[model samples]
Target: MELLEERIRRDGVVKAGGVLKVDAFLNHQMDIELFSQMAEEWKRLFAGKPINKILTIEASGIGIAAVVAHHFGVPVVFAKKTQSINLDGTMYSTRIQSFTHNRIYDVIVSTRFLGPDDHVLIIDDFLANGCALRGLLEICESAGATVEGIGIAIEKGFQPGGDELREAGYDLQSLAIVEAMDPATGAIEFRS
Candidate 1:
Protein backbone atom coordinates (compact mmCIF):
# COMPACT_ATOMS: atom_id res chain seq x y z
CA MET A 1 0.00 0.00 0.00
CA GLU A 2 2.86 2.39 0.72
CA LEU A 3 4.14 1.78 -2.77
CA LEU A 4 0.81 2.84 -4.20
CA GLU A 5 0.51 5.89 -2.02
CA GLU A 6 4.00 6.93 -3.05
CA ARG A 7 3.14 6.37 -6.69
CA ILE A 8 0.07 8.54 -6.37
CA ARG A 9 2.10 11.30 -4.77
CA ARG A 10 4.55 11.19 -7.60
CA ASP A 11 2.34 10.74 -10.64
CA GLY A 12 -1.29 11.50 -9.84
CA VAL A 13 -2.89 14.73 -11.02
CA VAL A 14 -5.71 16.60 -9.37
CA LYS A 15 -8.28 18.41 -11.48
CA ALA A 16 -10.92 21.06 -10.79
CA GLY A 17 -13.83 18.64 -10.55
CA GLY A 18 -12.29 16.73 -7.61
CA VAL A 19 -10.91 14.23 -10.06
CA LEU A 20 -7.56 12.56 -9.46
CA LYS A 21 -6.31 11.35 -12.81
CA VAL A 22 -4.07 8.32 -12.34
CA ASP A 23 -4.06 7.27 -15.98
CA ALA A 24 -0.29 7.12 -16.11
CA PHE A 25 -0.08 4.01 -13.95
CA LEU A 26 -3.20 2.94 -12.14
CA ASN A 27 -5.86 3.08 -14.82
CA HIS A 28 -4.89 4.06 -18.36
CA GLN A 29 -1.36 3.11 -19.42
CA MET A 30 -1.14 0.61 -16.57
CA ASP A 31 1.63 -0.60 -14.39
CA ILE A 32 1.10 -4.35 -14.07
CA GLU A 33 3.91 -4.67 -11.56
CA LEU A 34 2.14 -2.25 -9.26
CA PHE A 35 -1.20 -4.01 -9.80
CA SER A 36 0.45 -7.30 -8.87
CA GLN A 37 1.56 -5.72 -5.63
CA MET A 38 -1.96 -4.48 -4.97
CA ALA A 39 -3.37 -7.92 -5.72
CA GLU A 40 -1.01 -9.35 -3.10
CA GLU A 41 -2.16 -6.78 -0.58
CA TRP A 42 -5.83 -7.56 -1.19
CA LYS A 43 -5.14 -11.27 -1.06
CA ARG A 44 -3.53 -10.77 2.32
CA LEU A 45 -6.38 -8.60 3.49
CA PHE A 46 -9.01 -11.18 2.51
CA ALA A 47 -6.90 -14.29 2.96
CA GLY A 48 -9.37 -16.48 4.81
CA LYS A 49 -12.44 -15.38 2.90
CA PRO A 50 -13.80 -17.64 0.18
CA ILE A 51 -13.44 -15.46 -2.90
CA ASN A 52 -14.40 -17.43 -5.99
CA LYS A 53 -14.94 -14.48 -8.29
CA ILE A 54 -13.88 -10.87 -8.83
CA LEU A 55 -16.53 -8.29 -9.74
CA THR A 56 -16.00 -4.76 -11.02
CA ILE A 57 -17.64 -2.17 -13.22
CA GLU A 58 -16.36 -1.71 -16.71
CA ALA A 59 -13.81 0.83 -18.17
CA SER A 60 -11.35 1.63 -15.38
CA GLY A 61 -11.81 -1.23 -12.93
CA ILE A 62 -11.19 -4.05 -15.41
CA GLY A 63 -7.40 -3.79 -15.27
CA ILE A 64 -7.25 -4.11 -11.50
CA ALA A 65 -9.94 -6.81 -11.42
CA ALA A 66 -8.12 -9.00 -13.90
CA VAL A 67 -4.94 -9.02 -11.80
CA VAL A 68 -6.97 -9.58 -8.66
CA ALA A 69 -8.74 -12.55 -10.24
CA HIS A 70 -5.36 -13.98 -11.02
CA HIS A 71 -4.31 -13.69 -7.41
CA PHE A 72 -7.51 -15.37 -6.23
CA GLY A 73 -7.47 -17.90 -9.07
CA VAL A 74 -11.00 -16.90 -10.04
CA PRO A 75 -12.74 -15.53 -13.09
CA VAL A 76 -13.40 -11.79 -13.43
CA VAL A 77 -17.00 -10.68 -14.02
CA PHE A 78 -17.44 -7.04 -15.00
CA ALA A 79 -20.80 -5.29 -14.96
CA LYS A 80 -21.39 -3.97 -18.42
CA LYS A 81 -22.62 -0.41 -18.84
CA THR A 82 -24.89 -1.65 -21.62
CA GLN A 83 -26.94 -4.78 -22.22
CA SER A 84 -25.41 -6.67 -25.10
CA ILE A 85 -27.40 -9.18 -27.18
CA ASN A 86 -24.74 -11.82 -26.59
CA LEU A 87 -25.95 -12.10 -23.01
CA ASP A 88 -28.98 -14.37 -22.58
CA GLY A 89 -31.33 -15.17 -19.70
CA THR A 90 -32.15 -12.95 -16.75
CA MET A 91 -29.75 -10.14 -15.85
CA TYR A 92 -29.04 -8.16 -12.73
CA SER A 93 -29.38 -4.47 -13.47
CA THR A 94 -29.06 -1.27 -11.48
CA ARG A 95 -28.74 2.47 -12.12
CA ILE A 96 -25.59 4.20 -10.90
CA GLN A 97 -24.66 7.85 -11.00
CA SER A 98 -21.13 8.36 -12.19
CA PHE A 99 -19.18 10.83 -10.14
CA THR A 100 -16.61 11.36 -12.87
CA HIS A 101 -18.73 11.15 -16.01
CA ASN A 102 -21.58 12.95 -14.28
CA ARG A 103 -24.35 10.76 -15.71
CA ILE A 104 -26.46 7.74 -14.86
CA TYR A 105 -25.55 4.33 -16.26
CA ASP A 106 -27.63 1.19 -16.31
CA VAL A 107 -25.09 -1.37 -15.29
CA ILE A 108 -25.93 -4.99 -15.92
CA VAL A 109 -24.48 -8.43 -15.51
CA SER A 110 -25.62 -11.81 -16.73
CA THR A 111 -27.04 -13.76 -13.81
CA ARG A 112 -25.27 -16.85 -15.10
CA PHE A 113 -21.88 -15.42 -14.10
CA LEU A 114 -23.01 -14.85 -10.52
CA GLY A 115 -25.36 -16.75 -8.24
CA PRO A 116 -25.75 -18.34 -4.82
CA ASP A 117 -22.68 -20.45 -5.52
CA ASP A 118 -20.33 -17.46 -5.69
CA HIS A 119 -18.42 -15.63 -3.01
CA VAL A 120 -17.33 -12.40 -4.72
CA LEU A 121 -14.61 -9.87 -4.06
CA ILE A 122 -15.50 -6.51 -5.55
CA ILE A 123 -12.57 -4.56 -7.00
CA ASP A 124 -12.41 -1.04 -8.38
CA ASP A 125 -10.02 1.71 -9.42
CA PHE A 126 -11.45 4.39 -7.18
CA LEU A 127 -14.09 5.09 -4.55
CA ALA A 128 -15.73 8.51 -4.22
CA ASN A 129 -19.48 8.70 -3.62
CA GLY A 130 -20.09 4.92 -3.20
CA CYS A 131 -22.63 4.93 -6.05
CA ALA A 132 -20.73 2.41 -8.19
CA LEU A 133 -20.01 0.25 -5.17
CA ARG A 134 -23.63 0.32 -4.13
CA GLY A 135 -24.76 -0.68 -7.64
CA LEU A 136 -22.36 -3.62 -7.63
CA LEU A 137 -23.55 -4.63 -4.17
CA GLU A 138 -27.14 -4.53 -5.37
CA ILE A 139 -26.26 -6.78 -8.27
CA CYS A 140 -24.56 -9.21 -5.90
CA GLU A 141 -27.57 -9.24 -3.62
CA SER A 142 -29.88 -9.88 -6.56
CA ALA A 143 -27.80 -12.90 -7.47
CA GLY A 144 -27.68 -14.08 -3.84
CA ALA A 145 -23.89 -14.08 -3.93
CA THR A 146 -21.94 -13.47 -0.76
CA VAL A 147 -19.75 -10.37 -0.92
CA GLU A 148 -16.52 -11.48 0.70
CA GLY A 149 -14.84 -8.06 0.59
CA ILE A 150 -14.20 -4.86 -1.39
CA GLY A 151 -10.77 -3.80 -2.64
CA ILE A 152 -10.11 -0.31 -3.86
CA ALA A 153 -6.97 1.11 -5.47
CA ILE A 154 -7.54 4.69 -4.39
CA GLU A 155 -10.17 6.24 -2.13
CA LYS A 156 -10.86 9.93 -1.78
CA GLY A 157 -11.25 10.16 1.98
CA PHE A 158 -13.01 13.49 1.66
CA GLN A 159 -15.81 11.72 -0.16
CA PRO A 160 -18.71 10.12 1.70
CA GLY A 161 -18.64 6.80 -0.11
CA GLY A 162 -15.79 5.01 1.65
CA ASP A 163 -17.06 5.88 5.11
CA GLU A 164 -20.62 4.96 4.20
CA LEU A 165 -19.60 1.51 2.95
CA ARG A 166 -17.52 0.87 6.08
CA GLU A 167 -20.42 1.95 8.28
CA ALA A 168 -22.63 -0.44 6.30
CA GLY A 169 -20.33 -3.32 7.34
CA TYR A 170 -18.40 -4.04 4.19
CA ASP A 171 -14.81 -5.20 4.57
CA LEU A 172 -13.40 -2.47 2.33
CA GLN A 173 -9.67 -2.02 1.83
CA SER A 174 -8.17 0.87 -0.05
CA LEU A 175 -4.45 1.02 -0.76
CA ALA A 176 -4.20 4.80 -1.03
CA ILE A 177 -6.58 7.13 0.78
CA VAL A 178 -6.36 10.80 -0.16
CA GLU A 179 -7.53 12.79 2.79
CA ALA A 180 -7.58 16.03 0.83
CA MET A 181 -6.56 17.48 -2.51
CA ASP A 182 -6.21 20.99 -3.91
CA PRO A 183 -6.32 21.36 -7.68
CA ALA A 184 -5.15 24.95 -7.40
CA THR A 185 -1.85 24.00 -5.79
CA GLY A 186 -1.62 20.43 -7.04
CA ALA A 187 -1.41 19.46 -3.41
CA ILE A 188 -2.58 16.16 -1.92
CA GLU A 189 -2.84 15.05 1.64
CA PHE A 190 -3.11 11.37 2.55
CA ARG A 191 -4.74 9.94 5.61
CA SER A 192 -2.22 8.93 8.22
Candidate 2:
Protein backbone atom coordinates (compact mmCIF):
# COMPACT_ATOMS: atom_id res chain seq x y z
CA MET A 1 0.00 0.00 0.00
CA GLU A 2 2.90 2.35 0.73
CA LEU A 3 4.20 1.69 -2.77
CA LEU A 4 0.86 2.71 -4.22
CA GLU A 5 0.71 5.83 -2.11
CA GLU A 6 4.18 6.79 -3.24
CA ARG A 7 3.25 6.15 -6.87
CA ILE A 8 0.21 8.36 -6.54
CA ARG A 9 2.28 11.09 -4.95
CA ARG A 10 4.77 10.98 -7.82
CA ASP A 11 2.57 10.40 -10.87
CA GLY A 12 -0.97 11.37 -9.92
CA VAL A 13 -2.24 14.71 -11.14
CA VAL A 14 -4.79 16.85 -9.37
CA LYS A 15 -7.23 18.75 -11.53
CA ALA A 16 -10.23 20.97 -11.03
CA GLY A 17 -13.55 19.36 -10.04
CA GLY A 18 -11.79 16.98 -7.60
CA VAL A 19 -10.36 14.71 -10.26
CA LEU A 20 -7.09 12.89 -9.53
CA LYS A 21 -5.78 11.59 -12.81
CA VAL A 22 -3.61 8.46 -12.42
CA ASP A 23 -3.48 7.88 -16.17
CA ALA A 24 0.29 7.37 -16.21
CA PHE A 25 0.19 3.99 -14.48
CA LEU A 26 -3.28 3.05 -13.39
CA ASN A 27 -6.25 4.40 -15.35
CA HIS A 28 -4.40 4.55 -18.67
CA GLN A 29 -1.02 2.93 -19.25
CA MET A 30 -0.83 -0.39 -17.37
CA ASP A 31 1.83 -1.35 -14.84
CA ILE A 32 1.73 -5.11 -14.36
CA GLU A 33 4.41 -5.30 -11.66
CA LEU A 34 2.73 -2.73 -9.44
CA PHE A 35 -0.58 -4.46 -10.09
CA SER A 36 0.89 -7.78 -8.96
CA GLN A 37 2.10 -6.19 -5.75
CA MET A 38 -1.35 -4.76 -5.14
CA ALA A 39 -2.92 -8.13 -5.80
CA GLU A 40 -0.68 -9.64 -3.15
CA GLU A 41 -1.77 -7.06 -0.63
CA TRP A 42 -5.43 -7.73 -1.39
CA LYS A 43 -4.84 -11.43 -1.05
CA ARG A 44 -3.33 -10.81 2.38
CA LEU A 45 -6.22 -8.59 3.37
CA PHE A 46 -8.89 -11.11 2.38
CA ALA A 47 -6.92 -14.18 3.30
CA GLY A 48 -9.63 -16.18 5.04
CA LYS A 49 -12.62 -14.94 3.10
CA PRO A 50 -14.40 -17.41 0.85
CA ILE A 51 -13.68 -15.51 -2.34
CA ASN A 52 -15.06 -17.65 -5.14
CA LYS A 53 -15.16 -14.87 -7.71
CA ILE A 54 -13.80 -11.39 -8.38
CA LEU A 55 -16.34 -8.81 -9.62
CA THR A 56 -15.58 -5.40 -11.09
CA ILE A 57 -16.97 -2.73 -13.39
CA GLU A 58 -15.60 -2.40 -16.87
CA ALA A 59 -13.12 0.12 -18.48
CA SER A 60 -10.76 0.81 -15.56
CA GLY A 61 -11.57 -2.07 -13.25
CA ILE A 62 -10.88 -4.94 -15.63
CA GLY A 63 -7.07 -4.96 -15.57
CA ILE A 64 -6.75 -4.64 -11.81
CA ALA A 65 -9.47 -7.24 -11.26
CA ALA A 66 -7.78 -9.65 -13.62
CA VAL A 67 -4.48 -9.39 -11.75
CA VAL A 68 -6.18 -9.74 -8.40
CA ALA A 69 -8.20 -12.70 -9.60
CA HIS A 70 -4.96 -14.48 -10.35
CA HIS A 71 -4.13 -14.41 -6.65
CA PHE A 72 -7.57 -15.75 -5.71
CA GLY A 73 -7.44 -18.44 -8.36
CA VAL A 74 -10.89 -17.44 -9.57
CA PRO A 75 -12.51 -16.01 -12.64
CA VAL A 76 -13.00 -12.26 -13.05
CA VAL A 77 -16.43 -10.88 -13.89
CA PHE A 78 -16.60 -7.28 -15.03
CA ALA A 79 -19.90 -5.44 -15.22
CA LYS A 80 -20.42 -4.04 -18.70
CA LYS A 81 -20.83 -0.29 -19.10
CA THR A 82 -23.16 -0.79 -22.08
CA GLN A 83 -25.46 -3.48 -23.31
CA SER A 84 -23.40 -5.81 -25.44
CA ILE A 85 -24.35 -8.48 -27.97
CA ASN A 86 -22.56 -11.15 -25.95
CA LEU A 87 -24.77 -10.50 -22.94
CA ASP A 88 -28.08 -12.34 -23.13
CA GLY A 89 -31.56 -11.41 -21.93
CA THR A 90 -30.94 -12.48 -18.36
CA MET A 91 -28.71 -9.93 -16.63
CA TYR A 92 -28.44 -7.85 -13.49
CA SER A 93 -28.38 -4.15 -14.28
CA THR A 94 -28.01 -0.92 -12.32
CA ARG A 95 -27.53 2.77 -13.04
CA ILE A 96 -24.36 4.48 -11.78
CA GLN A 97 -23.26 8.11 -11.88
CA SER A 98 -19.58 8.57 -12.61
CA PHE A 99 -17.87 11.25 -10.57
CA THR A 100 -14.97 11.54 -12.99
CA HIS A 101 -16.87 11.54 -16.27
CA ASN A 102 -19.99 13.24 -14.85
CA ARG A 103 -22.38 10.85 -16.58
CA ILE A 104 -24.65 7.98 -15.70
CA TYR A 105 -24.15 4.55 -17.18
CA ASP A 106 -26.36 1.48 -17.15
CA VAL A 107 -24.00 -1.19 -15.87
CA ILE A 108 -24.85 -4.84 -16.39
CA VAL A 109 -23.53 -8.25 -15.40
CA SER A 110 -24.41 -11.58 -16.93
CA THR A 111 -26.55 -13.84 -14.76
CA ARG A 112 -24.35 -16.81 -15.56
CA PHE A 113 -21.31 -15.33 -13.81
CA LEU A 114 -22.95 -14.61 -10.47
CA GLY A 115 -25.30 -16.71 -8.37
CA PRO A 116 -26.31 -17.62 -4.81
CA ASP A 117 -23.34 -19.96 -4.40
CA ASP A 118 -20.79 -17.27 -5.12
CA HIS A 119 -18.81 -15.31 -2.51
CA VAL A 120 -17.73 -12.22 -4.41
CA LEU A 121 -14.93 -9.72 -3.85
CA ILE A 122 -15.44 -6.48 -5.77
CA ILE A 123 -12.32 -4.75 -7.10
CA ASP A 124 -11.88 -1.38 -8.76
CA ASP A 125 -9.20 1.12 -9.71
CA PHE A 126 -10.68 4.08 -7.87
CA LEU A 127 -13.47 4.90 -5.44
CA ALA A 128 -14.83 8.41 -5.92
CA ASN A 129 -18.60 8.81 -5.65
CA GLY A 130 -19.16 5.11 -4.75
CA CYS A 131 -21.72 4.81 -7.56
CA ALA A 132 -19.81 1.99 -9.25
CA LEU A 133 -19.44 0.15 -5.95
CA ARG A 134 -23.16 0.51 -5.28
CA GLY A 135 -24.00 -0.79 -8.73
CA LEU A 136 -21.77 -3.83 -8.23
CA LEU A 137 -23.34 -4.46 -4.85
CA GLU A 138 -26.77 -4.37 -6.48
CA ILE A 139 -25.68 -6.94 -9.03
CA CYS A 140 -24.47 -9.23 -6.24
CA GLU A 141 -27.74 -8.79 -4.42
CA SER A 142 -29.69 -9.64 -7.56
CA ALA A 143 -27.70 -12.86 -7.91
CA GLY A 144 -28.13 -13.68 -4.21
CA ALA A 145 -24.37 -13.79 -3.83
CA THR A 146 -22.63 -13.09 -0.55
CA VAL A 147 -20.21 -10.19 -0.76
CA GLU A 148 -16.95 -11.25 0.87
CA GLY A 149 -15.44 -7.77 0.70
CA ILE A 150 -14.59 -4.78 -1.46
CA GLY A 151 -11.03 -3.85 -2.48
CA ILE A 152 -10.14 -0.51 -4.00
CA ALA A 153 -6.77 0.66 -5.31
CA ILE A 154 -7.29 4.34 -4.50
CA GLU A 155 -9.99 6.23 -2.67
CA LYS A 156 -10.75 9.94 -2.65
CA GLY A 157 -11.46 10.40 1.03
CA PHE A 158 -12.54 13.99 0.50
CA GLN A 159 -15.53 12.57 -1.35
CA PRO A 160 -18.56 11.21 0.48
CA GLY A 161 -18.46 7.86 -1.28
CA GLY A 162 -15.94 5.99 0.87
CA ASP A 163 -17.40 7.30 4.12
CA GLU A 164 -20.93 6.37 3.05
CA LEU A 165 -19.94 2.83 2.23
CA ARG A 166 -18.08 2.41 5.52
CA GLU A 167 -21.10 3.73 7.39
CA ALA A 168 -23.27 1.16 5.59
CA GLY A 169 -21.32 -1.64 7.35
CA TYR A 170 -19.46 -3.02 4.38
CA ASP A 171 -15.92 -4.37 4.74
CA LEU A 172 -13.99 -2.09 2.36
CA GLN A 173 -10.25 -1.63 1.95
CA SER A 174 -8.44 1.04 -0.02
CA LEU A 175 -4.73 0.99 -0.79
CA ALA A 176 -4.21 4.74 -1.00
CA ILE A 177 -6.59 7.20 0.66
CA VAL A 178 -6.21 10.81 -0.44
CA GLU A 179 -7.44 12.99 2.38
CA ALA A 180 -7.19 16.22 0.40
CA MET A 181 -5.70 17.73 -2.73
CA ASP A 182 -4.72 21.26 -3.72
CA PRO A 183 -4.71 21.79 -7.46
CA ALA A 184 -3.10 25.24 -7.33
CA THR A 185 -0.27 24.17 -5.03
CA GLY A 186 0.00 20.63 -6.49
CA ALA A 187 -0.13 19.22 -3.00
CA ILE A 188 -1.85 16.00 -1.94
CA GLU A 189 -2.53 15.04 1.62
CA PHE A 190 -2.85 11.37 2.46
CA ARG A 191 -4.75 9.99 5.39
CA SER A 192 -2.38 9.05 8.21
- Candidate closest to the true structure, highest lDDT: 1
- Residue pairs that clash (backbone atoms under 3 angstroms), model 1: none
Looking at candidate 1, what is the lDDT of residue 154?
96
Instruction: Report the C-alpha displacement of residue 163, candidate 1, in angstroms.
Output: 0.3
lDDT string, candidate 1, 56-107, tens digits: 9999899999998988899999999963344355788888898677788889
111-183, model 2: which lDDT tens digit per residue?
A: 8889999999999999987888999999999999999999999999988889899999888999999999999
Score residue 53 of candidate 1 by CA lDDT: 94
In Å, residue 60's CA in model 1 sits off its true spot by 1.0
CA lDDT, candidate 2, residue 71: 78
